[model samples]
Target: MSTTPDRVALVLGGSGGIGRAVSERLAADGMAVAVHYAGNKGRAEEVVTAIDAAGGAAIAVGGDVADENDMRAAFEAVETAFGGVDVVVNTAGILILKPIAEFDLDDLDRMHRTNIRGTFVVAREAANRVRAGGAVVNFSTSVTRLQMPTYGGYVASKAAVEGMTLILARELRGRDVTVNAVAPGPTATPLFLDGKDEATIANLAKAAPLERIGRPEDIAEAVSYLAGPARWVNGQVLFTNGGIA
Candidate 1:
C-alpha cells in the first residue's frame, strides 16, 4: 500500500482481536502506530513486534480507557513518540450478553463504564489533540440495528457511541477531523465465539447476504478508508456487516 511516513495513529484496545488487526493494518499502511492495551501487555508487545518485523513503526501503550488521566497519558505517550497523532481509533470495549431483566446491575455498570465512558474519554482527548485533517474512529455494534435478544446492555452502550459519534462530527465543524463509528456484525473471535454453539454461529453467519462471518481485517478496511481518504464520509455509522440489514 501507499506509505505516509508523517502520519501516526493510536489504536486503543490494540491488543485484542479486532484491535490487533487494525493496529497491524494501520502500521502496514505506513502510519506510525501506538498500540494501546488495557491489560494484555504481552499481546500488545507481540503486535508491536510484528509491526517492527514488517519494517513498520509501532509502540505499545497501556492505560485504562475509561480513566481520564490514564487515557491522557496514553495520548501523551503517542504524541511524545510520534510527534503528533493523526488518527485515534477506540476499539476498547466490553461485551456482556443477557436479557435486560436477567442482567446483573453491576455487569451493566461495568459494560457502560468501559464501552461508553471509555469512548467518551478517548474521543474527548482526540477532539482536543488530533491534528487538523485527522480522524477519530469509534466502535459500535450491529446489534443496535439487529435488535438481537440478550444483547440489551451491550447494545445500549453502543447506541451511546453512535450518538456521541454524530454529535462529535458536528461539533468538530471546520476542524477537518472526521468522526465516525464502525458497526460490525458477528465475527469469528474468541470473545464472540466463547459460549456460542456451531449451529448458532452458522445461523448468524448465514443471516448476512455474504453467508459468512466477518473478519477483523474486513472491519479494519472500513476504518482505513475513514482514516485516510474518505473525507466527506463523516457523522455516520458505517455498518461493515457484509449486507446484514
Candidate 2:
C-alpha cells in the first residue's frame, strides 16, 4: 500500500481473471483506473463496481485490442476522464494451445492478431499518450521459457510480446517511460484450470519450488511494482512464477 492518488491506469482485458486482479490492485493503490474489456462490458463493470465499493475510482472501457481505431478511442476515453494516463497494462490476449502440426493456420493467425498485434496496438497508443514517468506493462507467458508441448502457438504469440516489450523500452529513450513484460507460470485461473484435472494440476503446482501455482494477486504484485516504483527495471521480462525456472 502506498498510493499514487494522482496517477491513472488503463488495463486491457480488465474483465478477465488475471486482468481483473491487476485492475483492482491498481485502483487499491489510488490510481484512477479504466477497465478495458474485449466484449463483456458487464464483467468489466463488475470489476469497476468492486473498485468503487472499495473507495477507489474506476470506469469500464470496451474495445477490440487488435483494432487500431478501437484502441485509439480507448486511450482517448481514458485521457478524457482522467486528464492523462500514467500506466497502460495490456493483458488482453488469446491463448490457443495445439501442436504446430495440429494447429489450424486460422487459429494461429487469430492468436497472433490478438496477442501480438493487440499488444503493439496498445503500445502504439501508450507511446504517444502515456504521460512522462509512466509505464507500459505487457503480459507474456513462462511457457516461452518452459517450452511446454501443445503450447507452441500460444508461446509463439507471447514470445513476440517479449520482443516487442524490450524494444519498446529502448525506443522510449529520453521519455522516462519503462516498458516491461510479466511472464507468469501456471496460475489457478479459470482459463488455466478449464481442461486440467487434479493430477495434472498437482503436477504443475509442484513444478515450482513454492509447491503451488501462482495467484492472480501474485502476478498483480509484479505489475504493481513495474507500474509504480521500479523505475530502473526496464526492457526486461520478469518471470513471476515462484522459482519455476
Candidate 3:
C-alpha cells in the first residue's frame, strides 16, 4: 500500500450505501475524507458523524456531480478542509428500470446526465488536481456483463464509465496516479434491495456462487484495496461480485 500520512480523500455521492461505506473505510485508513452528497444533507451528515465517532477526520458537503460548477466547488471545500485531495471515489448514480419500449426519455436523460456526465466531471477535475501518487476510482456495475433485462439504459451509461476509465488511465501514465473502476454485483444496499420480497432477494443471492448478495462493505473493501494497496493496478474494471458473472 502507498500512503501519505496526511493525504485527503473525497467521495462523491457519499450519502448513499456504497459511498458511505467507502467514506468510512478511507477515513479509517487515515485519510481526511470529504463526503459529498447530492440531495440528502442529513444522510451526508450521518456519514460524517460515524467517521468522527470512530475518531476519523471527515466532513460533509453537497453537490450535484453532473454540474461542473458544483463539482469544482465541492473540490474547493475538500481542499480547504483537508489541504488537497489524494483520492477520489465517485459512487453517485441513478437507476430507472423499464423495458426499452416503455422507457421514459426524461428518465434516460437523467440517468445519462448523472452516471456518465457526472463521472467525467469528477474524473476531469481529479486528473488535474490530485497530487502525485493519488488515485481515482470510478464505479461501474456487474449488470453490464450480466446483461439483465430492463437494464439496457442503465448498463449503457455505466459502460461509458468503463470506457472513460481506460482512456483516463492511459492519459495519466507517468503521473504516478492510478485510475480504475469497481463493478459490484447485486449488493444489499437500500438502492438495490429496498423493496424486494425475501424470496426474490434470496433467489437473486442464490444465483451467485457465494449464495448471498454482496454488502456495501464488501464493495468498500475493494475500493480501499485499490485506493491504498494496489499501486500496480490501473485501467482495470474489477468485478467485485462473488463469481456471479
Distance from true location, Cα of 137 in model 2, Å: 0.3
Question: Which ranges of candidate 3 are over 4 A from the true structure?
Answer: 1-5
Off by over 4 Å in 2: 1-5
Write out the backbone clash pairs for model 1: none
Ranking under lDDT, best-scoring first? 2, 1, 3
lDDT by residue (23-44, candidate 3, tens digit) is 9999889888889999899999
Q: Which 10-residue window of candidate 3 scores lowest in summed lDDT?
A: 1-10
Candidate 1 local lDDT, 65-136, one digit each (tens):
999999999999888888889999999999998999899999999999999999999999999999999999
Worst 10 contiguous positions by lDDT, candidate 1: 1-10
Model 2 RMSD in Å is 2.0
Tens-digit per-residue lDDT, 152-207, candidate 2: 99998898999999999999999999999999999988998998999999999899
Give the clash count for model 3.
0
Candidate 2 contains a number of clashing pairs equal to: 0
Regions more than 4 Å wrong, model 1: 1-4
Error of 2 at 105 (Å): 0.5
